[model samples]
Target chain A: MNLDFSFFTLNIISNFIIKGLLFSIKLTLVTLVCGLIIGTMIAMMRLSKFKILNYPALGYVVLIRSLPFVMVILWVFILIPLVIGKSIGSENSAYITYIVFESAFYSEIMRSGIQSVKKEQMQAGYAVGLTYFQSMRYIILPQAFRNMLPVILTQTIVLFQDTSLVYAIGAYDLLKGFEIVSKNFNRPVEAYLIAAVVYFIICFSLSYGVKLTQRKVQIAK
Target chain B: MHYTFNWSFFFKSIGGKETYLTWLVTAWEWTLTISFFGFLVAFILGAIVGIFRTTNNKYLVTFGNIWTEIFRNIPLLVQIFLWYHVIPHFIPIINKAPRIVLVVMAIGLFTSSRVSENFKSGIQSLSIAQKHAGLALGLNTLQLYWYALLPQAIRIIIPTLTSEAMNIIKNSSVAFAISIAELTMFAMQAQEETARGIEIYLVVSVLYFISAFAVNLISQFIEHKIKIPNQTFVKQ
Candidate 1:
């Protein structure tokens, strides 16, 4: 029951833990870019005047948001082989599932951001002879992005924490790195405790930055 | 590549005792039980900490902030693993308790941080006028919160609370990591047994959606019923 720090040697960390941390960071960055792009598209669709565009986008967000991320990862891992006729490996599946799943949440944030932009702004764009898409791209989106940046950053911090779920499918994430090193050193408890502290410190510091930015954003408006 | 869709697997009997659907139903029952009790714990704990955050005492506010940060920052799966694997070795009483108890405790505490944040915002959204009114009536702090502040704040927060409730249900799936045999675990095992991964996961996804949707409906109903007339005047 003794807490042991000696289990975490420099050799084990550099060999095992660093690889997982790199993969986790890679996955988070990739998902953030892809999810935000797809989410912005979905948010635009949901806000469309045409019913043909909105309903399906609305349904996708609702359906995905309702299910657990772990379930989605498991579903993708099992179903991908059948769809593509070969296993894509857990790492690729983790990437695809997170991008798809996180898009739903990001879209919600984007939707609120887009809605917060004044209707008058779009009208003014039209008054100056700009197309709807052009107005959104040039005028509305920049302001909306400014308003929602803090929230988006906060959600990304959440996404970083969620990278731990990749372990459920045997994807090599930071948590998996700890698990392997712990097994090697026979100090599973200490390894997990250290992992928890690492996650906490990273998320806490990032969220503090988010809070500061949120206040500045509010002041700007 | 044509994958066979076994439509009858759900109703088909297993081991002459129960159908696959029955097993899924039982597993779903466990999911609901864990989420429901877990949310109850979160609501109570979150309410207390959230109130502490708004209190006059700086020490209590710091303590509440620390509780929220510690629980909120750690991923739920790691916390669940800690509770299941590490805590039992230290606290023999927890070791003696059933596995469900530990799972519930972990999930509950994990969710409490979000609930507290929502509660704090709800309280902060109220204006200084309400506080002045309560003090003008010569009410004590506890009485003021009980009769005047909380009722209105809870109403303002119903929408946020609904989403939190849904989140708790979705999060309970992580309980499967510790082998609690919840809906996610049931689906995983059933997929292995039947080789019908698509159908099994599809059904589980729908069940989760229905539970979350039901909470949404109930919350919307409560929100409609309790809405303040001319809310803008009171919003500040």
Candidate 2:
């Protein structure tokens, strides 16, 4: 088949591509913000001295980590409507699911970061008059967060890429937009190539940013 | 309306005493088969790429980086969709092959990047003295890798490999998106037919959990057994 590639067609597709990119950015950003907050809380709970605080957090991590992200997404989509008596739009539901799923993973990352902080720092903080929570807030957490920045960024990039899976759940993210465009034009190759380029651009830039930040962090240290 | 705890319903679905057994067995078979084949392909391809990435040759290293980045960044679901729907049209010769092959290939390619990274790091961690010793002993490149390097590398990599295996098992669920009738797909189908989504999903989760837990335990045991001795026995 001799295919005619036209400027007008390219222009039209570019608009859809931009929209898809915007949707992807929105999902990634919202999920990161929300997931990080929930993940930090869970991490704190997991790291708590009390068994009552730690065990439930441990169970949450194990259970969520064991199941596939797709299963969790489906469970939320299916169960939410049945149980809550309200329909969640595909886009919102995808964000919600990503937040929940990514939080479990990010919590582990945060817990490890917290654990990596030296015992001396905590001891010194106690040597001063500051309480445990105050010391964590003022000293230990700052160091841990600094150390964790590169890893957290890498995980964020991974989470951003993974947001594409929302396409499976009917969210109109970049990949889903490509699927729609490909079906419309019956040109899956062009559509997919375009999508791949966009994804590569995003991921590559994030990786480069991570490298740059790591160097900066090292120099500062 | 609250979901009543129907003990009989849950039991019948899980025990394989009812019609649900057919779906469960089929799903279990499909999931295991896909994961096994996919892991095999990924291991071979990943090992080659991993070794290539660690080579002194700059071009080969660039190729490895490009390959890993491309595969690792893209969502596996999109890759599967592209393989199933798009690739067949691009290569008319392969139109006769089953879609399952394409799905398997997609999974293998996507996973190879991760496995390759793990293997490359494992191999790179070997001491410079070990490579020198292999060279001094008049071993060829292949022999150096096979006899001197790989044994230790494999020992270091067992934990990572276990996690990768678990990843492949979980990822095989993407096969269901292409109508592969894997465990997840089977559960979805059964749920549709029976309107028992929660019960079927819980059972499916348990199935995945058991296999993943088994892999974890075996890897932990192997890792414990393989700890390097503190005393130096220099090959060089």
Instruction: Please report the candidate that would top TM-score against the real structure.
Output: 1
Name the Cα RMSD for model 2. Answer: 3.1
Model 2 native-contact share = 0.45
Off by over 4 Å in 2: A1-11, B5-18, B220-236
Shares of reference contacts reproduced by the candidates, in order, are 0.73, 0.45
- Shift in Å, residue B42, candidate 2: 1.2
Q: What is the C-alpha lDDT of each candidate?
A: 0.90, 0.82
lDDT (tens digit, per residue) of candidate 2 on A1-221: 33334422767667666677788899889988888889988999998989999999999999988987778877887788787788888787888888888899889888888898888989999999889889888988888778888988999998888877776578777887787777777777677766777787888889899999999877877
Tell me the TM-score of candidate 2's A chain.
0.92
lDDT of 1 at B25: 92
| Candidate 1 root-mean-square deviation in Å | 1.8
Model 2 docking category: medium
Per-prediction DockQ, in order?
0.70, 0.55
**Whole-model lDDT for model 2 versus the true structure?**
0.82
Q: Per-residue alpha-carbon lDDT of model 1 for B1-236, expressed as tens digits? A: 68777778898788788999899999999999999999998999998899899889999999999999999999999999788767776786887889899888988898888888988888888897898899999999999999888998898778888888999899999988888888999988888888888899989998998888888898898888888887642353
